[model samples]
Target: MAMRDASTQTEATGPLVQFARFDNGKLRLFSAHTHELRYFAISHVWGDIGWRKIPGIDGEFLVSAQKVDFIVNQLPDLVGDTPFWMDTLTVDQRNQAEVIATVQNIPAIFRDAGKTIAVRENDGFYACCADAIRDARSIEEFRNQMFEHCEIHKDHVQEETYLKRLWTLQEILLSDTVQFVAIRGGNMDPIRPFSRMISTIHPLEVLGASFFENISFDCVLVFSKAYVMQEVILRLPAPLRTRRDSIYNDLFPMVHAASNRRASKPRDYIFATMPQFPWYHYPKNAERMEFGDIFLDYWEQASKNGFLSACKMKASMIEPQVRRDLGKSWLPSEIQPEPACLGDFLKLLGGQLPGKSAHTGTNIHVTRPVCISPFEYDHPSDIIEFIARMTQRSHFRFCLSCSTGEIPKDQGLKNIPWENNLKDINMLDWLQDVLGQNQSVLPFDSQAGNEIFSNDMRSQGASQANHFHPDELEVARDYLYTIFFYKNANPTEDNAWWPGVRDSLCRLFEIAPASHRLLPILLLMTATICCGMPVSATAWLMRFFIPIHVQFGEISHIGLLARHENLQGHPTPRTMLCVGQHLPVAPLLAGEGLHETFFPIPRRHDPKRNVCFGQELVLIDPEDRAPIGLLPDILHADMDEHELWTNIKILYDEIAEDGIRIVPLSDL
Candidate 1:
């Protein structure tokens, strides 16, 4: 066969390779710039890098020998003598300019092809599924058959290397029609209409049930689902494809879909995603841009468009080393954005307006430093220790005052009566009150009528019968007291509930604390609050005691704080506090108020320095009333901390008329 390449006039008129018949039964290629040519495009994984000579009409050309042999042998059984353009043969790999030019025209190439054939070597499981689906009458019956026979071939499908290549995503997406050819035993097993298989095999259905009892099968299910979603999203119209309401919403699934896929170059990970992001512009010198520079540009663009409005100055918890290596303070090398529930916290603080806007290119300004605290902790463990000491001291006093004895017996603590005479007798409301007055309480009806003795059953839809039994209240109250008073017992040793409570505390801190560090902190914080310390003071201690310096367009200091202690670290916590602005909302909700963001604070090698980048909490100046806007400064190691503190004290003194008192650390 002789092949021709289309001329490079434009992407539409760009070169297409044509294959022609040859007397010697070898392929020959020639360049042609015409719209009338019809060809199928082959999409396959490059299994081996080694090259071998493939016979052409004029001569022989070096190509991935294994890939060429596999495709040539399978072609007759797969597509049946249809001429096609395989990238390996069509694109000159040795010519850099040709590769770049051809890559830019890839979308057009795939879209113009008559059909896209995805070639994969058949493994036992895929073969079995294909065989079973041919005879099955319904999806449910097919699923049943798959479940029965899947175990034998499950490993092959889960570990399929073909699905884990990045370029294959674009190839699969751009094609109008795709057919799968599973090659096995010199025979091509045709899986017609690729979308049909995707629609039938749902990851949740296959992986959710533990019927398989295999971890690898579960993994396969997850990856397959991601692959399906990635392809489906790409097939949507361009306008609907990448235009998302928020960056957080769009970036997660996009990154997740491509997570396990390998790219030849690290920058290709970001570049491949560009086709999906219509709004994003590649740098004019994209070919020369460093991988880190690409990420930095992405962060800048996202910030200018208001994507980083809610981002706090926390270092990457999982990939701290990656962030450090990138040497960009504003960009997180790890792509996981803060969760959406953080926005709920912003609403509570009256910080952000509800709903997303297409145009949120607000100019955020970080103003002068308010108060930089002299107080600093060396590690999260140090803060945990401080909380534990405070808790133990408070618990000892409570136990000493108990009427039963110096320390209340377990039975006595369990028997503590619910004060029925209280004016507000609603169990839910009372529980909220006990937890913290700042905590939001779900309404009785909102709690599925869990209220044991509420006469108000109107919200229950005329069903007083559905109310909880009156006896349940006594049990509920006893359980609540046990949890509340468990602080007096030695929490570190033998308490079952303490571990759960500690895990909750670790979550509250946002950053993952070292192992065995959080339980004591939770116990202590609870004990101190129960011992009559103001909830606000305890909250400030946990959230706003440590200062974090943030830089994006400008450098500024922000303090981490939470409004409600009880709900502080719930996975989707109600709110997070930005002390610099005195803003309390979820981390995701900080977009409007947050102007300057900082990442990768100077790395602290000395444990005794008591300086950490992503600490859980920080202290905010009580009187720093700087208007919310962007500020300018780069936080360097040599920066004057003394001057920063001086500015903070000035701000504190200026608000003397407001009667706000700065609580000293020693007082706590």
Candidate 2:
């Protein structure tokens, strides 16, 4: 029978439950009001066996006599004669109103009950393992023996089907006192406490498929059941059992966990987890508010405020290679054919899965510093490509010119390509022609106006190779030197000039040799040196071209570069997150950031509203620190690079304390 809709039921009192009590040679059924909150609840997988008519019960929907005997015999020892609620008996199958009422309050039934006894009907392996390992003294000894037993009797291992049911996720998560028991051969076996089970089996289970070589598939399946059971226990609030307040932190994890679960009815996939939302209430008219709208309303509230904590924890835990694969701009929409689980997403990212945790919020209150750096790229694409090149996968190499860190380094520039017309000449000869002693660097000679850098500018932002006549050298060198020296040396550096030149370079070379854009920068540096131009010119331009830097506390090194898209004002800075902690497996923001966009996601509260994704924010190294200035010109011409870095650092630290401002993303 269908359950009654909200209008017929009071949300606070909820549906009435038929509780079964076994007395002296008799079993009696009595209805209990939910508000009394006295009965314990039973959560188990319903078997395929036909119903058995209890002598006094007046219905065909009665559960099997074996299950009734298992409950009557074993449940008393756990809860001591406490009346319990089971769906088959407690929910009226013949009445539609009672069914709807009971279904709507499924979450509350488990949550409000005095205790929840999770019954494993088929599996006897746990009982066998417990009996065999009863003599073990230490956890190590228990685990070793447990693994051995699982292997020896792998053929008989049965996975806990209760853990795989979609409805049971909430049943176990919402329950305060969840006791697991297995009914085997008309006997009951009490499962050990979650703490001991996790300590005993988690290490081997984490080894995953590799650990299954010596172990049988049945054994692996049983261990996986233990893993899922452990996952539910981990999500529950500890010390104090009921934490209605922490549901926001767990919402996304619940959704992801449900991906692996099975539901009898398709809509039950959504309905089962509905009670986990703290904002959810039993509606007066279930037909009035479509489930889609109700879910979107919940998603909107949850997506914006709570997930930063989980994102930060995941960011801190993931590896360096995974972070690089994301390359900063990865929003969830970018991944082709959405991933099903965290492991699937990590697999798609081409990285190893990290050690499993609940991925809950760390509750650390931190903030993201939003200070601007003087080094602005012409377009986001320029920086994206440059960062992509630094990775082991990309071909761009900086050689020895990179001062920020020694990376993308190779013995003196290897792949600098010359223009198509000059390809016949060796690169050395080409350089000599352009910068030889008698030659004047190309410049504006109105009559035969030479455009030596026109091809370079078109192909690479501000840097490209072009054939030049000896007479064209003077104007080209002078023009190059003016733009370089003025922008680098000007007390009031006009950040706008480079961005314009950078965009022009991108537009020109978008269709050029995709891999060789950086070649022109190196070629230009070589030209400056061959022509007896100042050595400082090469150093100055290198700083601008590779503007990004990263550090882990005092250790200055190249780690990962992320472009912050929240640009404001001139001289937009790409804020570098310096993780003093070990390298994380996922980019702090982008990994779960994809989940945020796609939906089905699952962090900590900051009373001050200053929580950030990563752990620490250290000062950038002075030796390699790039000059960063906020808009409206914060620097004076006389200021030294060290002093400019110091002032900017003070602001960085201050802004970090203020925290990042979270703007809710648009609906997916």
Candidate 3:
């Protein structure tokens, strides 16, 4: 290219660097900071053919396809007298020093440009949407005109490769005005103001039908709103965009939305998004920063700024992936792709506790310091097996006591063993005490039985007449009668009868509200597992199922546990469960020389078998003096193993609650 000097200048005494202007038949460079330069920046994908040398610019490069079409056919008419910035022709990508400098200057280049032209080689849908958007007078009118066209092209819209690219987010956001170029017919669509699009189109309406159907509608709505908000920030003037508080709130959702998008280089995921954060300092040796190092820097900064909570909350929503390892205890993983809203994620984690703040909002609150502790488990499979065995044993013992009319009347059933060995003398002593009382067995319709059933029906929401079919009620009633009276009257000694009793009891536990003592026992057992104590200790503790109070220095309202073995090389380990406070209690071991860390529960069939072995537990820390928020206080109740396991499973599957998988004993 030939160089030419111009009069206008912004600052500095140095010679203004040359920028190529591809107008007319001439190839000439003008001072980037001079000549009152009004340029449109070109953002397009670099295809496989790579860079080719342009004849007039020495060995300096231009993208091969751009030399053939973009400059020759599309630019002259569209840009007219204005100079345009096309990286391929303007920057010497072959020169490492020049490449680094250009990369660092990208934010300024895009921001200063009069407009950004996005060149896509696709046809149909985008062209149609562009035309409709260009003609609409109002957002509602735009929506009305585009809705049917969007539906017809929904598949094409969803499958658009351009939308899935990471750099495109910054390219479109930094520009004041953007024009879409469809290369199919060399059509340059009308320029649409970037800020206007943000205000006009609802993100949900842009979602294709298939994509829309896969997520919860409410979640889609929430995410759609968040998308618009992020766009609004991106369109802000540079100074406002750089404000620490304003940008920090948008980072979580922006990161989440970008997770599934493509990055040619792994580290580009971080670098490409950096333009959105004006506060980010591009490293001196920007290209040398490794992905892990970049992520660590981000984590440290986010934690210091209190953005880590939002990151953690987003991390709780998705499953863990093997390749990406942003797994520090506090850092959220970008490896796991989440398509739903934060509200939906919380619902998936066992529906947020009734009154608790969901923590999905953008407002940054003072986060209390959380104590991290390792849960004791050699393998997740081991915990899974233990849960199964303990659950079966507990179910057996509970059924035996109920069948023999040994359950106490006033305080409900108590002192049930966690073991299955029926020959223990304590069982005989319990049986003798029941026999000596000579308590009269009441009919099923008696006031006490009526009261028990009524309470159960209320808890189960079966009190409403329409809740269950007539036949379902008969099944429930028959099972209750057999366990409560028939089995007691018959007094069978057959070993074969045990299976029926266990099955009947499991069903009863499912429909009936567990006895008052059951919840506390369950809570204690969960806490024991979280503390990394022996399983046998938990079993022994079951004998004293009376009102038990657990104390910890600080407690995690929710936590996850996975085998430390699986997390050896991972920078951030997946958590197993979002253990609510009170139930899963672990000691605060920070600065106490405890290097052990817990991971989230891996999916059962996850190839990472070493991590998936145990029954997951949720625990609390006693030392934390921070406000508990909405964590439920541990209830005082005697719970059978079956009831305890069931509640554990319920909590494990709660929406947005991370980790903690409950594998059924029968399945094991």
Candidate 4:
């Protein structure tokens, strides 16, 4: 597509060609909290470095109140005589002022248009370009969008001066080439996880916060020559700017703060606005407090989620320039500024994802499917599920969002509960208990109102689980399905739900998978009535599926690590000595399954110094401990793998030998 400038009269009146541009090495373009779209130092070269119309994904920088303050602080000391301030587009987008000026020079485009040119201004100037634009939508549309743009950023970018200033920044600070710090899973020093959302990662956000505690940068800001007199794109009411030259008034750092310091150019600039306060804001020496385990603090549960590569960051860089040249391009910016609206949030949530949501009927107070005896929840997802199935005729299902560490491993079978806590747990035990007498609880709920399924309803020849006791039903429910838990070599950086722990849900509940793309359908109903297709459903589709749906709010469950993912890499699948995440994490033909891996943490003496391969699963129960071997045919090790297996085998042998010597029935 050919690019267009402001001066070019639209042969066919429509949107102008103000392309999105990027100069900084950034992962994504983000609208700044300030009026101007903020640009960040992407810090790396990228391949797909360009722009797209997508919101939030377009830019790298965020003009927080701080960055804005910092920029103003860097301005030269002479403020009164400064004609005007120009914030130029730094990326290659609008570096060609001549091109912008030529295109913007539309003398006859507007019926009353005189001339349009790029210019900058200082505080002494008149009613200025209170707003800017890369392209004019409609004269009216352009003006309105500029209003909302100004409202959100509190500063404008589409102004000619803004583009000019940005261009200056590129000439001064930015380089055509820079190096990006790379991320490799285990190879990068000590591999640790990162977590967020729960405010557990404040220390990580302060990558350089403390570096500024006792020290400041010896700084210099290179400025470009100023220009004057060009018609401003948008106008505002009394309090806002009034003339073209007045636009420059925005250059000096003046903040709407408690102190309200109106410094056009301060001797030593600090910040425009403060960030969200951390848990520890101030204390005697908190600035010097030790950062205990950075990895543990910021670790996201292991999942190989997706992200834009370095090149993509580069592509997104072009956006700011587009915004700068186009000057407040949005027709109705006030309509959508952020993710406060559901659709807006979903837009940022990527695409039509496959998800599930819980049904109000999937209630805690509701009775459970009765369970038969001699059985227990065999795995983490089973405890309450057994109860939910008693009155039902189909296999139930549920979804959960959790960490890799939350899935359970069977040591020797007494139905060991994984790390999932009771508050984080939900079960169908009540239904199972009620059905224990081999009688239907449906009879008691005569007022359930719905006669068809409410009664002891079933197909004539169907084999219902009614014959089973609550305990037996419990065992069947637990064993029928098992989870497959594996760790991601790299964690998902885009999702906020990770770094989570275990949460088990009925497979049919449909609530948890609300994010998944699956939709509830009329066909799901037909099948349930005719062919009996297990009534398979997720948490999301269930609520609306029921008529006159009553909302039961939501069950609050503790977000825990779902399961420990072993991302290091797994050998090609073969039946040699592999441990799959299931009821029996690793079986031994009824032999032995180890408990956990323990190392000599004390550097040969400190028990704490030992890591479990630094993992917990390496340790095995004394009864289940035994050295198992993998066939050589399916094995391919590049020395590192061999050494790992060898060390693991040694631990297994030693633990087995020692455990057998002292393990008791209670230990199992």
Candidate 5:
């Protein structure tokens, strides 16, 4: 999946059927039924392709010249409270709403009357936006309105991290020569900064490996109509509260109380936020899942949409036992926790396995605990590598500059790459340069540890590094180290950004092009497990078994089936015909389609001893028809004990009828 920012997200997939900028001046809605891409813009003004001034969408406009407030009024009543406003708007309304919103809320500082804005950055646009904000009432509100607007704008573009924008905070994101043009006046790039100093609006992105559940950021400042650049400057290194007021020491209670309110209906607007799912488990994406289990993370966004009332109570819905075992006690209350039953866990496992039953099966089956684990929340190595790169940027230090409350004092302008503070000039872990009067930067690519120690006695300039620049090796190392150290650095399981991370990983990355993303979901963490041998090998073989072998396919040992007598929970049943409620796993192991019972290799040989190669095969899905060729031999296809195991390969190909592709588990 791609790293989705707010701008490119508004691009309609398939064919954009309809579009319009509403009189409310803040909404644009569109939908592609086939693609299920319903969009809504809710900020100043959306910037995208239009399909004429369609009728009907010209509904009653509300609010004022301020597009976000106006669009807010235009929406069908009662939806503003939902996590994403799209839940309330109609399909057509959503699309048009998106376009209008994106175009409108563009910061006044970045608005260029008629100048051409490069897709990357244009100075003219920011000037116009800066002028508009001079009279704006609440800076926070303006920032919120703008961010909410852009979130809809770039919800779907795949190459999300390195986004291709339509306008900049100071100019149009597109160039005047081609794809885009100025809306109001002549095309000319602006060469000025915003007239007014716009206060930064650093919104929080949940931390998760999945799509929406945890993709939320610590804080990202709105940079353009559809993009939010990570803020690298802050007044304090702590969580800040709302800037609108000066009351209260900790605003936790206020924020919590505000969070209680919620929308009562389903969302109609569909942007890039889609629920993620495991690929292999989901039939729609089965083929691609061969690489790894698909992670359905779109739920991250849903969860972030302000739906949780009581997480403890909610967990009970899935497994009340979990709640009983784990629940906080408040006041003098005594909700004595219930002891977990080992037997119950066993039964749950057995139910899914073969040769187990409520009447006869006596073993207790337990799976990996349902609670989230450290690995689940840990950022994978791939994304860590990216962090290493991002930290080396001349702008790298600012990436982590964020405050939930007020902005911090600027750390004066200096030039010795800020990878390290300016205490010592030549130590990787030590300060590289002091904060005095040096403006030279070394943007070379190498290990931070190696380069910091040996500086070429010859240099004088600014360090110009991109995301891949190793000058900030310390950045990746420290960022990843911080994540490892911080208990809750990841927002997945605790319900911060799990839904977003899950959905994005499954839909945008896993099921689709594998690495559509530059970094893991939360700065660095993979949501979906790609189904393939290389990754698995790198994990199990390189890390566990063989240290020398780094080859991809050479590590096909991951999919091998062990004699897991407890596959589901109990032993494989030799004969379900004799018993009543045959366990689900018993038949599943009877080769491919075991549900329908159309084909059975072995009817009832022995129910006591473990069932293996000689065991019968039963096909359940295809009208009780038996599988053709060597399916019976395939399931019972053991290598060590059976003599034909050696010659089985030759016979498998010549199975009388059709030619089939067969490879050993080692070859897979």
Candidate 6:
């Protein structure tokens, strides 16, 4: 039996594809389009370094002598004379144009094939293991025998030869039916489905955990890649032949799996996974394109989920400056993007992706932002206290978004009764009382720490404050989970949330007297504000800061950073644009009159104004008379009840004296 290259017509028609079968003891090769013929596709590790010319009747086909011998001697019996397609003979790799055109179609070839049989050339370890487990009585006995065989064959390969290559993922995943075969005792053992071989691993993992110690550990589980490939393939929704569109949703997981696998060519890493995406097409000039450019191009065209997922991937070198120049400051530069793990991949799929979408060639327009004047601070502690106080204020607003059963229909801020003097009510204590005692307040299981935190926050022990009640402990625990776990979507990145807070607390405590008690409470309040409800748009809005450098100019850029991400340094006055809004809790207020009308108030347009718990008012500079900032048109509960009416009167007077001018700020 002999093989030949695909015909010129076949290469030109679509993807370079050919099928071979033994007719009357002679191997014959014929050309055909995808899905036009019923063929068994062969996926195998190429036995040679690079493509070599194999002499044939009409032209030289791309296949090595080693692979040719295996196909002619073994493939015929494996597929039982059903015409088969393998990359070596099917692809005319000698032609560069044909290689590019057919690279993507390889997956479809395997996918559309009647069956796929992976040939493990020159591998006898699987045969020994199969024979060892054949006569076993129980799963435990089978597991021990397998481990014993592995111990004996320590020098032999620990993993299947076929599964070692990076390109096998696509070959295994896309195929409808797949089985592993090799030269077992000069003839093939009964061909086992890929799943059947994978099934042997669970007994050892589940029931024979201790059996690993008895044998050379690496040898005991010979086909670990099989387990990994099984997991990767199983993640895909079934019936991929009919529903190729479903693969888009599982793009990140496939990418994550691909990162573990490797290809000889750098571009093959991206090309191998391209088939999973039906919408994406490999660039015509893909051979010349850098890996990063190709990667960005692929993800940019991906579904919204995939595009965002790529942005979050961990990379050694990220081009923030390049991204900024590209007008997509939100996206990182040239990353060798890799998701941390399978769990992280699923988290991106299930959890909320990064918010405040700033795409390429777009202005970051920040609407209704509050601007303030620069103030001199003697110490960094002042900044911590400043940030902590602002965090508390933000938390107060965050509570407005949450609704609970305890609050009456008339009440605006539910469950917790916030008083008129907002300064007196501690936001953390309120959250502790509401969420801890009333377990049913949130939709998710509040008590289940593992459900939320991959790293259990409850294990962090008591809060920094020494004397805290059990309920306070519980709140602190859940609060840490809400903050650290959710904020750092990529687990590999440093958990920057607590360290930043700890440093701030340390600086603040150096000056303040009662530092012991204040640390935990302030920390809780900070986390509450930074990561409000994981899914809330209001929570999303809170993370953004409109940087006002000189403290007296039109806002240009709005920066959004995850609190848990490592902070290079403290955001100086130039970067810290403190903007906030008041919660409209007027409906919940026991009494109403002039307060019922939620309108903007007129205060002395003072310079160097800090964020305060005031009603609808965008503080402006009276002396400069500059258009300072914008605020949401809503009433806050903290202002003095009488002061509210006085501001209203002053607002009317100011309106008459100086007609309010609406000036638009330049686009960011």
Query: Which candidate leads in lDDT?
Result: 6
What is the clash count for each candidate, in the order shown? Answer: 40, 26, 62, 159, 150, 1
Which candidate, 2 or 6, has the higher lDDT?
6
From the highest TM-score down, the ranking of the candidates is 6, 1, 3, 2, 5, 4
For candidate 6, the per-residue lDDT at 58 reads: 37
Task: Say what the RMSD of model 4 is.
Answer: 26.9
> Where is the poorest 10-residue window by lDDT in model 3?
346-355
Summarize candidate 5's per-residue lDDT along 1-668 as a digit string, tens digits: 35354323522222233332333334455433212322222212232223333224445332222223323343323223221122223333335444433322232112111222222122123334334333334435545554444344332212211121112211221111111212222123233222212222222111111112122232222222222221112111222112221111222222211111111111100111111111101124322321111111221222233211111101122121232222211000111111112111111111111321211111111100111101111233433333333222111112222111011223221132333331222322211121231211222223542332223301210122112323333332333333322322342456454334334333433332312222222232111011101111111111111111011111100011111111223222211110011221232222242223222223332323222222121111111111110011122222343434332332222232322222111111
lDDT agreement of model 4 with the native:
0.20
> What is the per-residue lDDT of model 2 for residues 1-668, given as tens digits with 9 covering 90 to 100?
13345534544575566777656535567876666758888888765546666554555664666676665566557555578788886676666556555666786677677767777664433556666666655445656676677677654444445544556655765665555666646332244222223323433333222223223444444434443232222223323223233332322331231133456542344456554554444444433443323333333343443322222112211111233322221111111212222322211222111212212211111122333233232343544333322321111112111211112112121222224422433222221232223221222233321232122222232122223322223322332333333233333655555455445434544544332323333334432222112223332222122222332232222221111111222243344432121112222342344332111100221212222122222222122221111011112223356755543343234333333222111111
Query: Measured by TM-score, how close is model 3 to the native structure?
Result: 0.42
Model 6, range 1-668, lDDT digits (tens) per residue? 12234534433344546777777666678877765777888887764544454433235555656665665566667777688887666666677777777776886687677777766654434555666766665545656676686667654423344444556756766664556565434322234222223223432232112112223333234323333222211222244432224333433332232122336665565677665555567888877665545666665655343333323321211222232233343333243222222222222222112222324321111213333322222243443444433333343333332211011122111121112312222332212222123220112222332322323322331122122333433332333333332333234676566455546445534544333233334333343233222211211212211112122233221122322122223333322222122221211121222212232333432111211223223322222221122222122334455745543332222332332222211111
| Candidate 5 Cα outliers beyond 4 Å, as residue runs | 1-17, 20-58, 62-65, 68-272, 275-402, 406-668
Model 3 stretches astray by more than 4 angstroms: 1-18, 30-37, 53-67, 124-158, 186-239, 243-246, 250-259, 301-562, 565-668
Query: What stretches of model 6 exceed 4 Å from their correct place?
Result: 1-16, 23-27, 50-65, 79-81, 122-124, 135-144, 184-237, 241-259, 304-307, 313-326, 332-668
After superposing candidate 1, which stretches have Cα over 4 Å from the reference?
Answer: 1-24, 32-36, 55-65, 76-83, 133-144, 153-158, 185-258, 275-288, 296-668
Query: What is the C-alpha lDDT profile of model 3 across 1-668, one tens digit per residue?
Result: 12223312222222234566654456676666522566777777664346565444445454645434655666667667677777776776776666655654566667677777776544223545666545555445555666666656544433333444556656755665556654544322234212222222433333311122223444344323323222211233434244354232432332232123455664465556554454455566656654434554554454454333222212212212221322222233232212122211211121111111222211111112233332222232332233333323233333322322222112212232323212232321101222233321111223422432343422332112121123322232233333333233344454454346545444433343222112222333433323222222323222211111221222222222221112223333222222332112122222444333233522231211111121212321222211111122121124545555444443333322453322211111
Give the TM-score of each candidate. Answer: 0.42, 0.39, 0.42, 0.17, 0.20, 0.44
Question: Model 1: per-residue lDDT, tens digit, 1-668?
Answer: 12222322433464455443222355545555424566677777775465556543233334555555664565545545445677666667676555554554465556666677776544223544555544555445656666665545443334344554566765765665566554445222234222222323442233212112223543344333333222211222222334443333322321231123455654555555443443455566766655445555655555555444322222222122322322232233222211112111111111111122212222221222233211132233344433443334334223322321112234432322223222223422212332233333222232432332233322222122212224333333333234445543566687565456444434434443221222222332343233222221222222212112222122223222211112223333222212222212222232444443332222231222212111112222223211111111112123256643443343332333332222211121
lDDT of 2: 0.37
* Model 4 misplaced regions, further than 4 Å: 1-420, 423-482, 485-668
| Candidate 4 lDDT by residue in tens digits, 1-668 | 24445313332332222212222322222222111222122211111223323222343332333223322342222112222112222233333343333222111111111111221222111123223433434434433544444455432222221221212212111122111111111021122232221111111111111112111211000011011122222211113112211111221111110011121211001111100111111122322222111111111100111110000001011112222221121101111112111111111111111101111110011001111111222232332332222112111111111111111222111342323211122221111222234321112222322322222322211222122222332222232223212112123444222122113233422343321111112211211211111222111112111201011122111000000111113222111111111110111121144233222211121112111121111111123221111000011112245544543342232333322121111233
Alpha-carbon runs more than 4 Å astray in model 2: 1-16, 22-29, 35-37, 49-56, 62-82, 94-100, 124-126, 136-139, 186-246, 250-259, 282-294, 300-668
